[model samples]
Target: MKIYRRGVKLDLSIAVVVMFLLLLHMTGMMYKRELHQLFNEEVNISKRGFRRFRSSEIVDKEDETSKVPSEVAEGPAGTKTDHIPAYNMFHQRITKDAMYEPSAFYIFNLLDELATGEISNVSLFPGGSQIKFKIHFKNGNVAIAKPKRHDRGRYWAYDQSEPFWLDNERHNAEIASFHLDRILNFRRVPPCVGRIVNFRKEILPNTKDEEILSTLYINNGNFCFIGNCVPWFCNDNNPICSEGDFMEMSLCVLVYPSVEHPFQDRPFPWSQGIVESEIWKERNICTEMLVDPEITMGRFFLDLMDLAVFDHLIQNYDRHHFTIVVRFNVESFVVIVDNGKGFGNPWKDDTSFLAPIYQCCRIRNSTYQTLLDLSTDGSKLGNLLRLSLSQDPLAPVITEIFFATLERRLGQVLREIDKCIENYGNGEVLVDKVVVI
Candidate 1:
């Protein structure tokens, strides 16, 4: 109004004001946009995180490379998983020809005879550190050929007293494992011939070092009367049968085939029935029965061998040795032949895993020590175990297999039982003991 004629100062002031306003407006808009973006991104991010934590099927897949299935409840490393929930993980084997050896046909045939009650004294011979013996039916007609060191005159009876621990679970597991082993061995990915058959738990009475033995269910004890590979099948019809040619597998006759199974067994729906399948074994040999029965020899040195497997008579809660006998077509195989459980823990006992996993891991214990000192390398068992880790017989290559498998499956099992703390199980679950003589 004053006709200022637009002085330079005034013009400059106006320009400055305009610039200020423009700057303020731009800043405000940028602030609003930034706020909107931040809120939106936060909401989206939160939603993803929620689902990632909430759903395992979904979130777990995203982290597939990072997750491990829990074996024990709250593993030793403070892992959040409740391993117990995933208890007893078995890669179930539901087939007959798990082993497809030409030997299997004959092996199965001989086994069928026992299942149908054709023979008696089905004995499992010892291989390495295994010792499991069982008696099928009382062949009063048959004699106890391989009596233990103490048996003066104990004839074939279900109630014989011996030094081994026998039970339903051991027998059942052996049968089930045998099925697996025979099949794998058939393919020769691993040596099936050297597998420990039925499992026999041995209790040393006053000693802390109890023995867990597996057997081979020998057709005949490790001696030979014939050349080539042929086990003399035990036949009662021939009263003059010798433990010879040199030995035939102990035979068991299931005189009256049970309308139901003779042992504690669960058959998968598609299969006939499951005897023990040796899912994991020490060797990866073929699953052929001995073309030369003599090839199915017992462990060479008893004093050196550790655990016993495939023994016929486990007489704890129920009898699985009978099941083993039926498979080999034999009865009354050799066993420690005692009814007392070492720690009074039966096959079905809750703490059974601990016994094998923690209790039996000791290197100084007789069973463990025997295995150590007797090896060709004395300490080379580690080499064998390392070789076993590749595939097929996933683990459980030694007496420690049950121990290892249990310690693994029972990552939760150890939760309830604190026996390890009580005794410092110094048990090496995955690693082997270094036996320094």
Candidate 2:
């Protein structure tokens, strides 16, 4: 009787072990199925041909590196990750000195005040082909000013599809970009404002650059001056003239504290090339960027994807180069500058501007969510932009045609995201789970 009882107990124990193993297998299958439903399909490891670690999985041991906020590290007790890696990356870098970081409102107000103030000093801002002036205010503030080059209602007649069209930077675009950046909740652009200043009184009198002074002249009773000639087009033949005494221009605020934050200008991977073989449109350059040793170590890939989205919305195709802030031994923060090239042609929708999106097939979840929130009836992107730009000194910065194009382009972006989600699962497309450690 004892032997029979032992045999029964052994059989019961074996059955329980089998059931437990089966439950684990079933759970994994269910989890995978759910993930697929959330996305488009289960991402095949073999298809990608490489193993990519999630941002959460890429651990950083150094204390100097930007710390992930507590809210991001540990969300509501049982919830999944709720923090966006891309947004957090930018936020952390900018707000490292939260005690001193100026609010958007403060910056905007200060910029306006400075614009109205006297020009204590003025000099030629070197490097760019176009003529830019570095103006100093009596309050020790400085700004870079770009004179109004083109009228608002005009559109470039060149073929945007070629990607190498001759385009002039517009002052209105510079001001509008700042407003648009704020509306998109990505305050990457520096504070900018438009003001009509007297060329003879405020600017030419304070001018320090010999080249700038040499170009100044008078035409038809109005103050006129040809800027330094560029290799391509700008010359005495086409000079920017003021209406009598006043010249309209956009002033971009320059705010660099005493602390020296190192900035490096890196060439865009998909930069336009004159040579046919160097064209990036025909290739999946994102795959190359992903495998790069430096890019893989930090959140560079995610930043590029975010930039692609931002540039696409504004129809900026001249992202030939970008500046990255190297701090804490990582290349994380991307400083957005040179926005004058955008908003040139509203009718042309350049799909090539979205190479990072379609080629990489990845996007930050926070960016996607914010885009959806702004796309609604009451909070449409166009209305928000229109309202924001109206507050500027130079109201009606952009035309109604440009506003309509922005809304249309936004729809196209959302559709592209939907297509990506349909093709790949949510697990594959939405890569915002990455946390900067």
- C-alpha RMSD values across all candidates: 30.3, 20.5
Cα lDDT computed for each candidate against the true fold = 0.23, 0.61
* Stretches > 4 Å off in candidate 2: 1-93, 96-103, 160-165, 257-262, 276-278, 326-331, 433-437
Error at 238, model 1, angstroms: 32
Per-model TM values vs. the true structure: 0.20, 0.73
**What are the per-model numbers of colliding residue pairs?**
101, 4
In candidate 2, the residue pairs with backbone N, CA or C atoms under 3 Å apart (3 or more residues apart, or in different chains) clash, namely: 39-425, 39-426, 40-424, 40-425
lDDT of 2 by residue, 1-437 (tens): 00000011223333333233223222444333433322222221111011211112222222322234521122232333233222222223353212112232134334444446557788877767677878876544567888887788767754754343467778888889887776666666766878778777777777777776777788987787776758553686778788877778888865442235545677777655445326576677766767676655655667677777778877775677766655424544556778887887788887777777887778888778878876776567786676556545566788877878888888888888888999997878888634322
Query: What does candidate 1 score on TM?
Result: 0.20
Evaluated against the true structure, the overall lDDT of model 2 is: 0.61
lDDT of 1 at 49: 11
Kindly provide the TM-score of model 2 when superposed on the true structure, using C-alpha atoms: 0.73
lDDT of 1: 0.23
Q: Write the per-residue lDDT of candidate 1 for residues 1-437, one digit (tens) a residue.
A: 00011112223333333233223222444333433422331221110011101011111112132233321112332334322111111101111222123222123222322222212343433321222333332211111112111111121222344222221112223222333222112221111111111212111111121121121122343311111111221222111112322212222212213223322222211110123223213222222212323212332111111112111111122222211122322221122121222112212233322222332232223333323221323122223222222111112222333323322323323332244335654453212322221
